[model samples]
Target: MSLSQQQELRAILEKGLPHAAQPYLLIAQALNTTEAQVLAQIQLWQEDSLIKRFGLVVKHRKLGFKANAMVVWNIADEQVDDVAAQLSSCSEVSLCYRRPRRLPDWPYNLFCMIHGTDREIVTAQIDAMVKKFSLSYVEKDILFSFKAYKQQGARYTKQGI
Candidate 1:
């Protein structure tokens, strides 16, 4: 895409796509371009690794998921990947990732987020996960979320290009 087109795309993305039936078509009209052209450019950008992810950002609380917790586990280094995959497959797990452990203080590495309408439900899901994974002996922690701030897409500027 040309520099001007890139700038326009970035601007549109910063404001986020419209919540309409034909968001891309609306965006195309607003940008004075065809919907197919806009979609082609977006696909090209994805192929070029410019866009890491493209999906809806749901408001969990608004969807009646009031209780959420980040469950961190200190699994063996060799088992982290397998455990992450297992947790990622669970229906209760909203997100799963692996992070380095802060040794001697924080030893947790694998992390998963669980969400539910009630705290007890979240806890029960966590318990089920532990039992299913035979993680009774695994060191873990649950940090519940108390608040959620506003969510927004990344802001890109022409100067940053």
Candidate 2:
């Protein structure tokens, strides 16, 4: 409701989600506001792009997803959008995005990360995606990850973002 309260909300969000069944409800109660208000504020922040990224960073290995591959694709400039959209829609795909290709070296522009329980599972998922979507990639590489680094959400300081 007030500037101080909004900063408090941001602080809570930056520390990562509350480990509760109804995390939002807890936050709203603490702010002496309704759950809807809290959600609305978050929505407004997202719409305004106040936060660059607001999503859970799942520890795939801890969840038994041992296999993960970053599928690098050199998709056609014209068809990349459609292909990326389709890839993003797949449940198997955890992340999909486009990056500028570095010519004379790295040529892949489109990227998607697929996770599974095993190497075979991840490989099959990639193969299935290529077949199911008929992704006519000029070049494709399945870069299986050998290691995973720590993942954390954005940090909201007392000064606020």
Candidate 3:
């Protein structure tokens, strides 16, 4: 794509695409381009590694998920991948990933987010996961969220790129 097309796409992305059945078609109309053109550009960007990922970000609290917990686990290094795959397969887990352990203070590396309508439900789900994964001996912690915050997509304009 040309520089101008890239800038226009970035501008549209900054404000986020509309939530509709044919959002891309609407975007194409606004950009004075065909849907196929818009989609092709997106695919090209992905193939060139310009765009890593694209997905919807939801406010769990607004959807009745009142209790949110960031569960951190210190799984054995050898089993980290296996355990992470298992955790990622769980329906209760909305997000799961691995990070480097900050030794001397924090040793947890695997992290996952579990959200529910109540604390009890969230706790039960965590308990179930622990049992199912045989994580009784694993060092883990659950940090509950007490406040809801507005979530927004990335803004390329603000990044001074």
Candidate 4:
């Protein structure tokens, strides 16, 4: 494949897939190529590890989810894996991950994001998770987002991404 065409395809995909019956055909037409070529190029990119994966970045605020809370927990190192797994399985948790805890000031090592239509809903969900997991005495904190930033996938090109 032409390097310029490959770069163009990458740049186009970074924006998002087109909403159409045959999105690949539309993209192929735009790039003056066949739909099969477009699909094959994407496959090649994936096989070569040029692209890790494709997924949607949901706009929770637009979907009526106004509150997003990142609850950080300081659980025992031995129990962290179990607690994180439990938290990750919860439907309310959008994201759950582990991070190194900073001593003296920051003690939270496990972090999970919970989103809801309102603060109360998110808070209630967090409370339920805490109780369900028996984490009442665990050191933790809830941080709510005050603003919604523009969210998008990775940009391969400097312009039009």
Candidate 5:
């Protein structure tokens, strides 16, 4: 893709997802192009892996999900994939991803999020998950929402948020 096309897509994503009622058509109008063109570019970007994900960024606290926790698992390297797949299929596990362990201090690779109305609920869910999965080497850290920082897509432009 040319620099201009990349810039246009970046702008659209950074400015927030396009409007409903034919959002792609609206974006096409803004770019002075057809909806098909806009869609094609989006598809190409996704194919190239330039677009990681597109979805709502819900502020859990605002939505009454006051309890936030990160459950880290120290599964064997070979078991990581299976554990991740199982964790991802659970509704309580909002987000699940694998990361490299830091060192002797941090031995967990699989990370999952559990959000609920309170810490007790979140803890119970995590405990249930650990028992159900038979995860012996798992550690959980409850993250209280003191404040929420910025949450948005990457903005390649030099403009302000």
Candidate 6:
């Protein structure tokens, strides 16, 4: 989808997903199109990679995950796949990704975030992950959020704020 289309869909999502009275119908009303057309367009957007995912944005802290930390790992270059597989399998991990390591200043390459009710629990989980993977070189750090200014999806459209 072009920037304009993405922006339009995002604008609608910002308002909220359609209600049960008429899900697609409501979206269609907002977009000034038929419900079927909206559904087909959304499906196409998804299939074509214009939309990565569409779902509820749950608040982790509200659900008791009060402690969240970014776990950066310096896995053996050869074992990145193995490590990422293990990390992704863990339910506590909410996000994981692989990126190039900036050595000397930043040695960790693979990043995974774990959420828990408290810092201690999160630390314990990280320890378990380390021991389970037998990753001796992996360095773990707990990054607590001191403040949250903007925690929401990206605004696809650039409307005057």
lDDT of 3: 0.87
Tell me the tens digit of each residue's lDDT in model 6 across 76-110.
Answer: 78988888999999998888999998978988788
Best by TM-score: 1
* Clash tally, candidates in order: 0, 0, 0, 0, 0, 0
Q: Tell me the tens digit of each residue's lDDT in model 2 across 8-69.
A: 89888877778999999999998888899999899889889996666777787899988889
TM-score of each: 0.80, 0.75, 0.79, 0.77, 0.75, 0.79
In model 4, which runs have C-alpha deviations exceeding 4 angstroms? 1-8, 30-32, 41-55, 155-161
TM for candidate 4 is 0.77
- What residue pairs are clashing in model 6? none
lDDT of 1 by residue, 34-133 (tens): 8898899989889999987777778778999989899999999999988888889998997898999998999999889998999999999999989998
lDDT of 4: 0.88
Residue 26 of model 1, lDDT score: 92
Worst 10 residues of 2 by lDDT: 152-161
Deviation (Å) of 14 in candidate 1: 5.1
Model 4: worst 10 consecutive residues (lDDT sum)? 152-161
Comparing 4 and 6 by TM-score, which wins? Answer: 6
Give every collision pair in model 2.
none
lDDT of 5 at 45: 81
Please list the C-alpha lDDT of all candidates, in the order they appear.
0.86, 0.86, 0.87, 0.88, 0.78, 0.76
Decide which is better by TM-score, 1 or 5: 1
Candidate 5 TM-score over all chains jointly: 0.75
| Ordered list by lDDT, greatest first | 4, 3, 1, 2, 5, 6
lDDT, candidate 4, 17-131, per-residue tens: 8999999999999888899999999999899998888888888789988798989999999999999999998999988999999998999899999989999988999889889
